[model samples]
Target: METAALNPVELEIARNRLESISEEVGTALIQTSYSPNIKDRRDCSAGIYGPDGMLISQAEHIPLHLGLMPTMIKNALATYGADRLVEGDVLITNNPYLGGSHLPDMCVITPVFWQDELIAVVANMAHHVDVGGITPGSMATHATEIFQEGVRVPPVKLFSQGTLRQELLSVMLANIRTQDKTRGDIMAQVAANRLGERRIHELLEEWGAERFAQSTHALVGYAARRTRAAIEQLPDGTGTFTDSLEHDGNQQRDVAITVTVEVSGDELFVDFIATDDQVDGAVNCSWAVTEGCVAYVIKLLTDPTLPSNAGLMEPISVTTREGSLVAAKFPAPVANGNIQTSQRIVDALLGAFHEFAPEQVPAASSGSMSIMTIGGFDETTGQYFSYVETYGGGQGAMPDQDGASAIHTHMTNTRNTPCEVIEREYPLRVEAYQIAENTGGDGRYRGGDGLIRHLTLTRGKAQVVAGTSRVTTAPWGLAGGADGKPGSVIRHGPDGDEHRESMTRFEVQAGEGITIQTAGGGGYGSSPAAE
Candidate 1:
């Protein structure tokens, strides 16, 4: 299985084929999914991994999901040994402590076999709408422990040798609020993995297992060389920066996140050991998530065209303190950590990188996902319905170009759920959806404007959970630019307008509505007028 015999052209072709397989898997999942979260918003990711759980290639999907997939698959494989896994078996898990971002994000893994030998594995993860929690949506802002957030599923066999585990599936669906959507999405994941398996088998048929393995090994090594070369371009330096979370749902404010980046030779080291301890609310993220955020910033700073495989991570090393905000322990609530904290982590890292490479970094963006979840009984359908969505915000402005307005930036890459879909599916109405005027900071290159979305209950009463950031601490500006405007949430009801906290859970009546105003991005440089 020596890769020395493989030529550059052949290796490039193999790389493209593998990447296409991952992209095809993602397409299959989105097309077959039942929930709007996956079908319309495309909040899902797919990847192909080697037999040893090393990432080979991934689709250009969510950055957060792509980086964490390798860790999740490796954990699953370690939990359930290869001897226990069969050809058609699919493993599932959403335990944050066990290498997952949150409880709602479910990962499905399938092992590909060639003549009784395990050669590769394909996996996909999707954010299910709801998974049995104290609140209607699984992301409870006030939830202090993981038990209250949602149903926790550890690494287990969802399918055994092409047979679905009916009893286990039944138990899982019984706990979730949107049973049909969850079930359908799970099946869609299975379908995606199945397609990946079939495609890999086709490749193995064309080229023997030995050649296939050799090509994959060669691709990974090539990516490693490219990443190291990119790192060598940066001057050796150490940069440190600190950022804070305005509030963690449980009244804790200014939860600090510190990062120190060191570039030596062709290697990079990111240390988060100085970060604050885990809080009492749902703002805590696991070590895998912290690593994912660091990996994302590394890719952006180094080379965006680098192949997204395990090799890309070879020249980078990350260290985080155990039980810290960026590396929470078991039993800590983490629903918002994946969406909210991840954004802040990216901002902190970029801020540190700016110290050494100011031209390479951009001003901070809206720095929030603006997640909104509403759930209750649907009068029209006579069933329970839960809707979950992450609203896009201002994108950070670059040195030479203006930022994009009302777009998903940094860690998230999801689309906004269409207004028509919300009105047609759930007991809610999209009263208004537009960009916040003049919100982006003014400079040589202005930052992007934030979004304003207002939603009203259409029929029955519903419970709403919203988590946001950059409310108290505005998105920071760089290179003498101005700070972006902060965000705010309000409830418009019979009692008039009432401001809400950064993280809050409330009930809304049929006539009541909620309005979310996201933060804008920081400017890149001082405006000509100011100059």
Candidate 2:
């Protein structure tokens, strides 16, 4: 099973199979999990990494994972030293500075053991429904630091020498609000990791460990070269784009972001130099997340055939201004950091790149995550429940075609929960769920249409924690296309009163109804002369 003797076609196939292992792990995490965020909202990612901490292959997971994961693996290796790991053990954490992006996003790392040698690590990171923060959903808009966010687990052994750590398990169950569900979700991640580990071992047995390791490295090198070539083709010059966050939870100040990309013969220099100061809100992000955002945009601009590993980001250089939203200082909160700002960063970089490669890039996308937090209880059944959902939006129109409507966008890969499933799981009713007509930005290729969802609070009081944009600044069109309509929210009270809602958290009392409408992306070009 020498590297050369093995069929090149087989080696490629093996790489693809390894990538699929990540998706399989994700499906397991979703199917057996207890929380909607894990099973329904689908805020998780599963991927395989080589012994050297570069991504091997993954099932098409969330866009956020693609940007943040390479660094996460590096953090894992740095913390554990990679040699102290053993068989039948799992490590978990959600430290923002470590392999984690935030408190809610729990990163689970397990080492793949092969004949008493360390070969690789199978890891899955998901947003737990609750982790004992100030809020039930663990989504606090006003937290000031990571400590206020939730439990900060780092590379701790859930299982040691093949035995479960019951004391640690008890502590977790006691701390989290959704105890039973969180416990089940944690085990689900462990199960998914084991599944991938078994598959990795099978591949090792078929090709032997040495050849497998060699192919892994070779594949990464191949991706890096291809990414570099993509950069080389772009005209040699520096271009910049800027966007903004409407406000922090304070809702009084606007946060800005500026990204300049220098393309010079196979090299890309990306810098976020004009961003604003960080705030005491859950909107700040770390340097790793910022780098991930840069990497994610390059992936969108590069050839899809290229492997998406750390190598693809190797030749590209990224630098950010200090005290900015992308590069937050310590003591700032960032529970929703990955979703709140990463997509905007991607959009900003693409905005500049489009000026150089119009044919290669599309117009602006649905620039916000339709994050909704709902809480209530079923009166007839008398069971308590509160949950949050981060929905996707329309994609931008491309050169050859129109964009998708009411779909996920930018750095997310989750599907909306079915109306039927929502009814069965909770005491809420989907009054209206359809495309918001006229929401797409008009162009030669029509922009994607956005979604409108109306629901009734049937039981008790419910709180909606919303953090979205495009309500103030509509999604922009390209090459003579019209701008898309802005997003809107309306709440109808029991007394037949209605109120327009802003982008913040508020309460919906019993007998009240709520409606949410998301915005669409802009089109690339104007329509051709009417037949």
Candidate 3:
């Protein structure tokens, strides 16, 4: 049952079936989750992997999650060999050094067995609101090491032999800020994996076990062939480019991430050996995240329409130096790397590709995630509240079309929390929410405009932590276009004073308001054409 024997019709059917299982897993998690971040914003991802730890199919959710999941699965398999994985056993991990993006993003892996033989592993990753840290959100902006960020769970069994590990679960719940929400979200992820197992079993039953195995191989091979053909079409040469992070989250200094993209024959190589050393701040990222960024950019460049699997990455290779910004070593603070540095890696890749194909590349988008977290205790309700959300910004203009306005671009795909929901859930008032006027750069195709959000604390005191970028080094334009406006975070006291801070944590009293102006995207070309 080799891949070469499978016909095109069988391959397409098999590919769709495998992808649908992953999609169904994500749908179940979203519908059953309690938090708005997962239920409404959909910050989770699901995927199916082969028995040999190769990615088979994934849902079109978070690119960061989908890309790093395969490595996490392989690491899990390496830690506890296949002989140790039993039916109804679930493995969990969030250690960045051990194939995780960040502490808050927990990866859940469950093996599916058919006739007592391991068939596949269904896995899902969800960004929990809190996992215990100095800050309420568990994503500390000023953390100098990984220990201060959150609980770093290594590869371990969360469920064993069809029974929940109550002690382990209790330890997890005891460490986080939001116990009920975290527990509910984790259980939802568990349920999603269970559903994935059932769906995979159904798929195996429909197609004979041997046929299913052969089809999976054939589909992956087909995708690899298609990607190689696409890569062969590009010009063969080395294109080197560099991009920067606005700050290291601890100071106003910049950290550079460089990429040298080489397209030789039918294969592509991305090397990050010359990037800056890992910083002490939360801006550093793990090697898994850097690999995810490269895989995602390659997928986007070669053929986005191709089915996502290990085969798509077959013709691509990524190299990163140890302890570098793109491949930080153990103990490096990396909470913001998953959110902020991941975006810069993509930008660097795009920059490298732009050297050969400028028309195919758009100007820079709102490069930062515009992260803001507000946590405090409410006297009226006699309880505590912690709210974490990322605001959207302008998207870069394309060659022929204008960039989308006030939207999440590139790495992150989460939606902004609606003002109605924010006011209803937290002790705050939405003073104003609108698109910033004249924020987008001017060009033949104008870049998108950023958003302006004004929030006022209603009662009690609140701690605000903002980890945003693209303020000092604004999004760059191309082909003579002007750069976009820089972003800013301003604190307006109840009386009259206004203060500016880009990346810092501060306290706010009742009646104080904060204004966030997200950066706009760069334009494509300098022309006074109708936009």
Best by lDDT: 1
lDDT on C-alpha atoms for all candidate structures: 0.90, 0.77, 0.85
lDDT of 1 by residue, 1-531 (tens): 455556878988999999999999999999999999999999999999988798999999999998788888888888878668887889998988877899999999999999999999999999999999998879898888999987899888999988999999999988898998999999999999999999999999999898888888898889899989988888788999999999887774898899999889899999999999999999999998988998888788778898899888899899999999999998889999977899989999998899887888999999988999999888778788998999888877889988888999989999889999988888888989999977888888888999999999988899998888887778877787777888888988888999988887799999898988999999889889998
> Across residues 280-329, which tens digit of lDDT does each residue of candidate 3 receive?
88988888888888878776666678678988889989999999988999
Between prediction 2 and prediction 3, which has the larger TM-score? 3
All candidates: CA RMSD (Å): 1.0, 2.5, 1.8
Worst 10 residues of 3 by lDDT: 494-503
- lDDT score of model 1? 0.90
Q: What is the lDDT of residue 289 in candidate 3?
A: 84
What residue runs in model 1 are displaced by over 4 Å at the alpha carbon? Answer: none
Q: After superposition, how far is residue 135 of candidate 2 from its true place, in Å?
A: 2.5
The sequence of per-residue lDDT tens digits that candidate 2 reaches over residues 92-173 is 7777776357777888888898899888889888888778776667776667787777777776888886788999989876
Model 3, residue 516: what's the lDDT?
86
